[model samples]
Target: MSENYYELLKVSPRATVAEIVTAYHAARNAFSPDSIAVYSLFSAEDAQTELKKLEEAYFTLSNIDRRREYDRRLQQGTVPSAPASAPATAPSAPLAPVVRLVPTPAAPAAAPSPQPLPSTQPFPAPAFFPQPPYSVTPTAFPAAPSTPPMPPEGVTGAWMAQARERQGMTIEDVAQLTKIPARTIAAIETENLSTLPARVYLQGFLRNLARQYHMDATATIQTYLARIDSLKKGAA
Candidate 1:
């Protein structure tokens, strides 16, 4: 299944880009050598090999153009088959003999004979302790303010800024959370197209940011592309 990118990433061929990203991250973590969950299940070399496959899958699927081409090839049923290999079976180790150890409770000691004793004087009265005076009053707190509504789809930059701020995220915070450079994020929010990368990379950045902000990634990308196209036509 090494040649099958979807299988390597553990995602269906119809998975969305966001789903593919999530699957890639999960697969990479599972095969990481430092991961405690699979530490004993895979050797370092084996982990590295699995990581390479995951990277290949992510790289191919993350790009829109490449994924489109890949999907086309898949529909044509033209994907090359992997070479067959003999099944590898490891010999199972023999089970060790089980030994059960049970401890026997010591026999009950002989009952001690009862001894008669004179009644002792009554114990002194216990002293009283003073308790601290404390009272808890229930206080009602004011409800949190509602966030402002995001701007319309055409105002991409304003929408992005409002969405980020509503989520209490700064440009630097978004950068760290999305792994996008702070400057690039700022450029995106400001609609400084010249400062941003090419359209392909811009699409990925916008999608990631939209996902992080809990916005509709598909809608965000579509609106962003439309805005760019409008600008290009106006300049032309």
Candidate 2:
């Protein structure tokens, strides 16, 4: 089986962008060199290796275009998730031999014997373990209306997205121009309330976005914030 980035982050295939961000953060915390929990089970080097993979997966999945393309490839069985089977199998062969290859005759190898065993036991092979198949159905987006309606009096997140597109700006472009983090920008655009900043921060973000798009700041803030409140109330 190839490397599934979703499985790498321990998220389902259909995870939301916010969910992917959350999982990436959690994975980083777990695999960071300073993390003792992971160190207890795996070597600092091994943990770091995992961190690289995590970052790779995060960067790929965080971008909307990259993620959509990746998902398309995955659905078509064209994506290679991990290294080849040979290299993956190569690790096991060396691991058992390395224990025996230890120079007990040359040096004080007493420490090496007991040292590796304890850590090895705790390093559960999650990547190697069998996980139930997660079905990711292709998401079908609806076609836009043939006639573009007049812009509404109340602003919306969708309007911001539309305006950005009209200006031929990608999400990354907006992120760079506004100096907002890409993940945060994506969350705001998608209206993922759980992933959005607090109200105070969001107001500032909305203002920044408004200024960037030359929209009415006051109406942008009021409309978006009011929508947030309505959603929160509905959720409750």
Candidate 3:
């Protein structure tokens, strides 16, 4: 039977070319960034082999003729054939088995002895190692872990706080840098949403703060978005 390429790529057989490319990129990203020699989740050698498989799958699935031929061969329980230009070779001959027969040396016979048959009594019970004394006491299992509470809807404050700390800048220093008031910076860090300007301006302010702090601006935005979403869902 043909190998299941869909399963190898972790995608449905009916997946579009774009979906296959997306899956491949996602797999590539999942690997450790420090290890650049390899691709996907394998050794460099194995990754090369895997990449070949991926390419083959993409190629076969992307072309209707190739896909149909592959499917036809798979259904017929036959491997897909090469082109007419391919050479035909003789069938392989069976290999001969290696055998070594050694004659046993005769032993010197001395005496014949009579032996008594064992009794069919039950076998003695095996002795087990002494174990520590213990008693079963039922105890309630711990409660399932709870998900962390999402950050507040206006987390631009937290972003501002983290950014300033990373930059080794105090609120006064940030005030000098941005010419904004120290109180505004303090309000941003403390997440006093009411003290900040319009909601639209909040994103820009947080983005600038993130750049100054060398923090991930995208992640900061996502956190704020998640918080806002939770609040909208009444989950905040």
Q: Residue pairs in steric clash, candidate 3?
A: 157-188
Q: Residues 57-86, candidate 3: write the lDDT tens digits.
A: 545543445556545544443432221111
Candidate 3 residue runs with Cα over 4 Å from true position: 1-156, 228-236
Give the runs in model 1 whose Cα sits over 4 Å from its true position: 1-3, 83-189, 192-236
Ranking by lDDT: 2, 1, 3
Q: Write the per-residue lDDT of candidate 1 for residues 110-159, one digit (tens) a residue.
A: 32443222233222222211221111111111222232233465547777
Give me the candidate number with maximum TM-score: 2
Worst 10 residues of 2 by lDDT: 135-144
Residue 4 of model 3, lDDT score = 46
lDDT of 3 at 185: 70
Per-residue lDDT tens digits of candidate 2, residues 1-236? Answer: 33567877889878766577678878899888888778678777777777877766776675566678767766655553343112233343235434444664644555443333322212222353344232222232222233234267566667778866654457887786668888887877788888999999999988887765546778788988888788789989
TM-score of 2: 0.41
Task: Report the candidate with higher TM-score, 2 versus 3.
Answer: 2
Estimated TM-score for each candidate: 0.39, 0.41, 0.30
